[model samples]
Target: MSQETASWVRDVLAGRAEPVEPRPAATVMLVREGADPGGLEVYLLRRVSSMPFAPGAHVFPGGSVDRRDIDHEVRWAGPAPAEWARRLGAAEPLARALVCAAVRETFEESGVLLAGASADEVVSDTRGADWEADRTALIDHSLSFAEFLDRRDLVLRSDLLRPWSQWITPLAEVRRYDTRFFAAVLPEGQQTRDVGGEADHVAWMRPAEAIEGWRSGAMAMLPPTVSSLKDLAAYATLPGVMAARRTIVPIQPELREVDGEVRLVVPEGVDYPL
Candidate 1:
């Protein structure tokens, strides 16, 4: 850890610093099949260094849940919010908001909409001038997610999302997020655009390649991202990943000073090479 990180841990451990409450957030790993058999690729964004949180780090598409995301008026399909609540171990409203935020953020950050005109369908092409206008509005908060979907007569495809895991920001950090992780296959016919906003660069990379980049010091990632990628590397195909059952458990790393260096201590069985 750096000098600042070590000092923060010392202050927080000594009760000289108070930890901020983590904000509820959501993120999704958008995956697709590669040209090679049993190969999977994931979308990643490198946040701009000037951003307040996770700057210069490669991350999945996501953000904090908006108040409008919880509104029940939004169209829905597949499993109900109650079912999602059961799966996520959260309340129905929160579960709905998390799913909504996951879809909304993915579209805002990657130009991929996890919605369709009918329950069994997904939007084929989210391109052209009018689509860009609504996307811009959503980013600016000038339009609510419910309103956007209602206006377009689209249903939020809840079945498209698969619950993966949950991670809470460590107490030593000033900005914290209680983020829920989700996995979804890239909808057919929808392509990722540069969509430059919070991120300066974006790309599709196999999980193994991403892990190698992190190991080689060519990429920056938090422990959660590293762990997620490591776990993802185990899967051979997108369907295999989406079909696997997961128990959503919250993992929060603690800060400790060992051998004169501050280290983030994760729980047992959750291993990541530092």
Candidate 2:
């Protein structure tokens, strides 16, 4: 931790400062099969340094929920909101909004849309001027997820996503998020483009390779991103990752004075890459 962060941690711990309430947010890890038979690769975006949160970090596509994310008019498929509520350990309303934000952010940041015309189908491609216009509208807040789905005559394919984990930003940080992490397979026929906005670079990399890059200081990632990459590295294929059941639990790292320096400490047995 930097000296400035350590000072903030000390202030917060000493009750000289109050921690900010974290905003609810969601992020998704998009995975796909690689050339190596059982190996998988993940989609990642290097956030531009100008970003307030995790600037210059290689992160998944996600952001905070907009008020309209809770719109009831959104078309849906797969699990019901009640089931999503149970899985996310949230009420039906917030659960629905989180899922909506996940799908919307995925489409907004990446070109991939996890929606289809019917319950069993998925959008094959999201290219061309029309799709770009809608995406831009959503980014600018002129278009809502519900309005976009309704206009496209599509339903959010919730079945394509699996709950991974929930992470809360540490109290000492100036900005915080009660963010949920989700795992998803890159839908067939859809491709990721160099969608320039918050991110400066995008790539499809093996989880282990990403980890190695972080270790070599070639890439920067937050704790949740590193932890998620570690989890993904355990799986050999996309199916293996999607098939594994996850018990969604919130992990909020604590600020501790370790050897005269303040550091973010995760739970025991959970590794935090230095």
Candidate 3:
């Protein structure tokens, strides 16, 4: 059978002939030192139009958790996985995996590696080809992240990640992600490159400017992403951004039809997911 025919058959078997279901996912926002106090620049990826979900949207790097993420073992920092699970009101295993996936996806989508010892130590030259090969193997299900870490004797560096918000896609959408958002300052000397083929393009832009771009029709963004960017725009520095994160109360907005168009409206004084 032709490749197109095989894809259609697979989709039909997976119930894509009907509607898609909302699944758990995670996104990481990478900030780096810039010229100004609020020089916070976020890494954005424009997903390819051929993807099954959120096709052609400029989004933070993230995706649904694979079963392997749950079983994988690696040294970790930050809040315990169980604690994160409770805060997110999800099962322990799934929550833990979500965090792992967030870190893994960030590295895969961007060339920046958040996991390492002191920022100084990470600057030593490393083999990008080797890392890319491993990433490909992991994505192909031939290697687990746990194995990847073990082979490299690296830690997960959970302390580098901070929970920002949680969001659930509207039920009306055929595809959805129960996504958790995390923030991390880019490690010293680690630069972000657009290497993930899933994204057609990538850029580093301040939150306010990105929102303005969206309004001016210079860019297209999903509602959650827009809302998140607006929230980030209120802060001026990495510390300020982290401080504001502590006060965030995850708000999953209710989707309603306004003027015959779908819109998500959240309660005031609450942080909406991106």
Candidate 4:
């Protein structure tokens, strides 16, 4: 390991350094079919190199949960906030905010809305000029997600989302997030565009392919993204994947120096590559 990294790890382990407080965040694995005939395809965006966090790394569409996302004024359908709280292992308000943030961030970043006018129906298209304006507004925080939904007469579809995993940024990093992960199928007729401030390029890619790129050092993926892709690569059907159950466990990787190499390491049997 570089002498600097080794010293940093030692300081952190010895409690000489305290990790920055992690802010709550959320991300979605938007999946569909295209690449492997037997596997699922996912949406990915490459953050610009200038981004303050994870620059140039390819990530799912998401961001930190906006405070207004907790607004009770939002019209919600599907699983109640209390039930989601039990599943997500969080208080009701945070659970509601997480779900609302998931849907809102997805629309803002990828142009895909997992909401509907009624409980049973999802919007087929989001290509209208007005929709783009709202998307931009959401990104800039000029419009709250609740207001947008109310104005459009849409209901947030919490049922459409499946909680996947939770990961926290390492304390060693100045930028940190307590990010909740969600997976949802790409809605039909709606498409993801290369939108967002830092994402300059976007694509519908297979998890295996993305992993292969990372293996070849042709792409950059954070530890959580890498681990999730490995897990995602195993599933072939949307129904099977979504039908599976998961217990929400928070994983925070630690930085360690091993045999002169500094590496960020997940827990044993965590199935993550450095």
Off by over 4 Å in 3: 1-21, 117-127, 245-250, 254-274
TM-scores, all candidates, are 0.96, 0.96, 0.83, 0.93
Model 2 TM: 0.96
lDDT of 3 at 75: 54
Lowest summed lDDT over 10 consecutive residues: which window, candidate 3? 118-127
Output the TM-score of candidate 1: 0.96
Alpha-carbon shift of residue 241 in model 2 (angstroms): 1.1
lDDT of 4: 0.88
Q: List clashing residue pairs in candidate 3.
A: 224-274
The residue-by-residue lDDT of candidate 3 on 1-274, one tens digit each, is 2356345435544557643476888898887755676478887888898888777888998888887788647556667888878766678998789888988888778865556643223422233899888877777879887887777767677667788877776544545678888888887767777686799999999988888888887787877788888877777788876665453355555555567444557656654433
lDDT of 1 at 104: 96
lDDT of 3: 0.73
lDDT of each: 0.92, 0.91, 0.73, 0.88
How do the residues 1-274 of candidate 4 rate in per-residue lDDT, one tens digit apiece? 3467567667776689776789998899999877546678888999999888888999999999899999999999999999999888899999999999999999988999999999998999999899999998888889999899998999999989999999998767667899999999988898888775879889887888899999999999899999998878888888866886888999998876578566787877677755
After superposition, candidate 4 runs with Cα above 4 Å error: 1-11, 35-37, 258-261
Candidate 2: misplaced stretches above 4 Å?
A: 1-6, 271-274
* List of clashing residue pairs for candidate 4: 1-260, 1-261
Candidate achieving higher TM-score, 3 or 4: 4
Index of the highest-lDDT prediction = 1
Q: 151, model 2: CA deviation in Å?
A: 0.7
Ranking by lDDT: 1, 2, 4, 3
lDDT of 1 by residue, 194-213 (tens): 88989999999999999999
